[model samples]
Target: MLIEAAGLCAGYGDARVLHGVDLSVGEGEIVALLGRNGMGKTTTVKALMGLLPAMAGRIHMGGTDVTALPAHRRARLGLGLVPEGRRVFPTLTVEENLRATAVPGGRWSLPDVYALFPRLAERRSNFGNQLSGGEQQMLAIGRALLTDPRVLILDEATEGLAPVIRREIWATLARLKDEGQAILLADSRLQAILALADRAVILTKGEIAWTGATAALQADAELQRRHLAV
Candidate 1:
């Protein structure tokens, strides 16, 4: 497994959101986390990223125990997060934003980022705040890719975008997966995600309500009605 977490318990203040959540992402596979809003989806990602302290459990990357590592350390260990929002540096130019957080692993460089998202290359000189939502999102993905992470985690990657932009982002993800990228993506588009994800885990009330192959989950009407339908 490229990433694994078992018995993960995380929360804010005194309120716990995740209850012993367990999941894994295999190398070169896209694992999707599916659920309604407030179902600990983002909380789970935060916990895995070590942003939300894990009250209990283990987070392992490439079979090494990193449960105690800080966020920056984890990043060095090849874990990258795109986060829920496209949290780009508003004050920085596109090139500056990518330069500031570029990793030295020598795996992904500025040329690679520009090649992956040519649209970003066109706006390379534009300040982050001046780009459209889709452009900002492209920059966000580019930023994460520059880290050359072993496991890429994205939360709400396609949220608040036009249909064309969402499709573009999904296509980008597909291309990355084709290039053997290991991704753990959380999104609200079940049909779109299911099409690309090899496996799916559904969270209900902070627990794994259902887990199965992506195709099986999509075929399960009962499962959809119980946990996915809004």
Candidate 2:
């Protein structure tokens, strides 16, 4: 498995958010972490990335125990995160942003990222703040890829974007999957995720409520209504 997170427990100072949540992503597999608002999806991502301390858990990446590693160490160990918001550097231009965190001799190069996202190449000279929401998203993904991570974790992969742009991002994700990228994605769009993910894990109130193949979840509407309906 590219990522193995088990017995994960984390929370803000006084409010506990995750309750021993467990998730895994294998090589070349796309896993969806689905849930309604306040269901601990983002918290899970934070814990995995070491952005927030894991109150209790074990996180293994490429068979290495990373529970104690800092965020940067985790990144060096092949974990890349395109966080909830497309948090690109507002002062840096598109090209600079892509260069800032790039690893030496990485599998992904500037040309490769630009090829995946032509819009980025067109706006390479534009500052991060100058880009539209969709453009920022593209830049974020491109920047992460430049790290040549073993597993990519996308929190709210396509949120607050035009439908056309959302589709474009989904298509990009599909292509990445086709290329043997392991991904853990969190999003509200049911059909889109179901179409892309091999397996789905549903969270309710910070605990895993259901987990199975995507096809099984798609066939059971009641499960969706019970845990995912707004």
Candidate 3:
């Protein structure tokens, strides 16, 4: 597996939001982190990325135990995160944001990212705050890709976007999967996730409710209704 977290526990301050959550993303795999509002989907991803410290768990990246590593160290080990809020640097231009955390001599470069989202190329000079939500999302994905991460985790991958923009993002994710990139994403769009992800991990109240092949989850309407339905 490119990234693995077993018995993950994390949260903000004293309030724990994840309880023994386990997740893994192997090479060329696409895993969906599914759950309703206030679940630990964001916390789980944060713990894996070392943004939120794991109170009691082990995080391994490329077979190395990275439980003690910080966020930048984890990034060096090829764990990239596009955070839930599309937290791009508001003061910097689009190009600057892409270059901020970029790893040199990697498979991905500015040109490559621009090619993946040509809209970014056209708005390269715009500040992060100036772009529309979808544009900012594109920039966020591009910035993460420039890090050449072995495992990419996107929290709320398509949270509040127009249908057309969401489709574009989904297509981009599909292309990344086809090119053998490992991905873990959290999103509420069940049908889109079902079509793209190989596996699904459902979270409920900071605990893992279910983990299995996406096909199995899709076939079990009861399971979806129990954990995922609004």
Worst lDDT run of 10 residues, candidate 3, spans 185-194
What's the lDDT of the predicted structure labeled candidate 3? Answer: 0.90
Model 2, runs deviating above 4 Å: none
Cα TM-score per model:
0.97, 0.98, 0.97
Best by lDDT: 2
Instruction: Write down the lDDT of every candidate, Cα atoms only.
Output: 0.89, 0.92, 0.90
Q: How many angstroms is residue 157 displaced in model 2 relative to the true structure, after the best TM-score fit?
A: 1.0
**Model 1, span 1-230: residue lDDT tens:** 88899999999999998999999999899999989888989999999988989999899988789899988988888888898888999999999999988978658999999999999899999999999999999999899888888989999988998999999999999999999999998875587897789999999888999888998988888888777743
Check candidate 1 and list the clashing pairs. none
Candidate 2 per-residue lDDT, tens place, 1-230, comes to 88899999999997889999989999899999999988999999989998888888899987799999999999998989999998999999999999997998999999999999999999999999999999999999999998889999899988998999999999999999999999999866587898899999999888999999999999999998888853
Q: What are the RMSD figures for all models against the true structure?
A: 1.1, 1.0, 1.1
| Candidate 3 structure quality by residue, lDDT tens digits, 12-92 | 899888989888999899999999888888788888888889988899987799999999999989988899989999999
Ranking by TM-score: 2, 1, 3
The 10-residue segment with the lowest total lDDT in model 1: 221-230
Instruction: Give the Å error, residue 200, model 3.
Output: 0.5
lDDT of 2: 0.92
